[model samples]
Target: MIRIVIVDDEVFVRAGFSALLSLADDIEVVGQAGDGAEALSVVRQTVPDVVLMDVNMAPRNGLEATLQIVKLPEAPRVLIMTSASPDNTAWQAFATGAHGFMHKAATPAQIIGAIRMVAVGGTATTPEVMKRLIDENNLRNPRHVAQARSRIDLLSGRHRDIILLVGRGYPNARIARELSMSENTVKSYVSRALEKLGVDNRTQAALLVRDSGLLDETLANESRVL
Candidate 1:
């Protein structure tokens, strides 16, 4: 049997999930909790094969708990369930070594299948969430690289050079020193680059720069110009 625990801040949600699991003869709801701390205690006691974790619990949210839970001896695979689209939170869940991510709106079949998959040490994720993770981690899908290259091409040469440094993991101060510009100027350039690229943070911009293969192209062009 695939032993399971359901963890959610809402009593109704925990109860409802447990009820849903009861319908699957091969799965067993071993315990339930209303918060992260309670979830931890129950997990220690039950040592379920899989944990159905709600992502937004209070005092100790699911992500925080998952981080701790994975350290224990023979930790259960945690499957995070969020109320909305995964976005950056999906990346965080994977960082916590979560085995799966799915919106709370997942159908009963999907939820059951996810739990079963996780129980057997498999990742359970939807296509959208998986794609987000691939992009977030800067995995170079060919199409993604093409898109990133086009966006980076729209940047001025100076901006392209700076973002290349950013992709090489340069800090603002280091970039300033390397380019013989003030730190404040580097910061402004970074902010503007991010704006033009339509990304929220330096990390995403760095990912774009790396994916775009822009560094080699820029260097070759500059060499030719020289």
Candidate 2:
């Protein structure tokens, strides 16, 4: 089962999500919190696989909470939900190492689907939000790309190879096979690489790798291996 923690400032919202999620046999609601601080405590206590959190809350907001959460050892995947405009918060969510973002107005199916996606190392952003994120913020602009490349440069060659493969959407077992290493070693290498890259998860690392354009260069260099 995919364990999940629900975090929202509103009691009704939390209760509603809990009730809705109870229907999914593959998902279990392990905990709930009414604010960012409480969410952190619940997350640490529950050790859930995924966390569905609202972006707005009193005192400490979701972005602040997410930053702290991802720093925890073996942190849970965070799917940030918002009722406000993505323009106001989506970029910050991505920066905080969120695995997914969904509008609060999304359908029940979309909500459940997003939770499932993030639980398994996938991103769950809608095309619209992503478009805004890129188009509005220039995340792929030359300056940002250069910054991404600079961070990626901090990785050793071996870690760079693994992160490039990770950007290609390879699972850990596949990465191990490609690199001729054991799965445990691949996991270790990936974890270390992500840490060095300052990303909380593989999805964020993948984004960084993509933005850095190293994956394209790696693919182009593959001909030399023949």
Candidate 3:
């Protein structure tokens, strides 16, 4: 079963999500927390596969929690839930290392699918949110962008190709098909690339690729290959 921990300041929201998720045969609600601090404790104890967290919380918010959570050894996937529309806060959360983002108004199906997606090493956010994240971040960091590009340049051509595809938000299966490699090979490449890049997950790698303006070059190369 896919183990999940629910973190929300609201008791009803926590209970409601737990009850809803319990209906899924493949998912188990392993723990719950009212804020980021409590969430950290619960996460360490449960070692869940996924964490559904509210973006806004007292004492310690989800973004702060996520920043710490993703650094945990073998961290669980964090999906940030928000009642607000995608904005600067959402971008901050993503940049801070959240694996996914979902509006509180999401349908049950969307919530379930997002959890599953992030659990399997995939990101989950709406296209609009992603676009905003890229656009806003692009305007903020030229020096860091240069540094990211320099680090990425150290990788082998194949590793760079895989990472660029990852930045484009393609999953391992699609990346495998595009690169003419097996899915397992794609996963291996991704893992090694993350190590070389010194990032914890695909989202951070993707951000680096985007901030460095490599996504455009990567796409052009991919078009020629296709």
Cα lDDT tens digits for candidate 3, 60-128: 999999999999997998999998877777767778888789888888988898898888777898766
Report the C-alpha lDDT of model 2 over 1-226, residue by residue, as the tens digit.
Answer: 9999999999899999999999889999999998899999999999999999998898899999999998799799999999998885876787788888899888889899888878866678777887775475444579887998999999887898898888765768778888899989989999999899887788789778878877767777886785
lDDT of 1 by residue, 1-226 (tens): 9999899988888889988989999999999988898999999999988889999988899999998887788788889999977878886786676768898888899999888766654467777776776566555678987888899887887787788887654667778889999988988888899899887555456556767877556667889999
lDDT, candidates in the order shown: 0.81, 0.86, 0.88
Off by over 4 Å in 3: 134-145, 182-184, 220-226
Off by over 4 Å in 1: 137-226
User: Candidate 1 clash total?
Assistant: 0
The best candidate in terms of lDDT: 3
TM per candidate: 0.61, 0.81, 0.86
| Between candidates 2 and 3, the TM-score winner | 3
lDDT of 1: 0.81
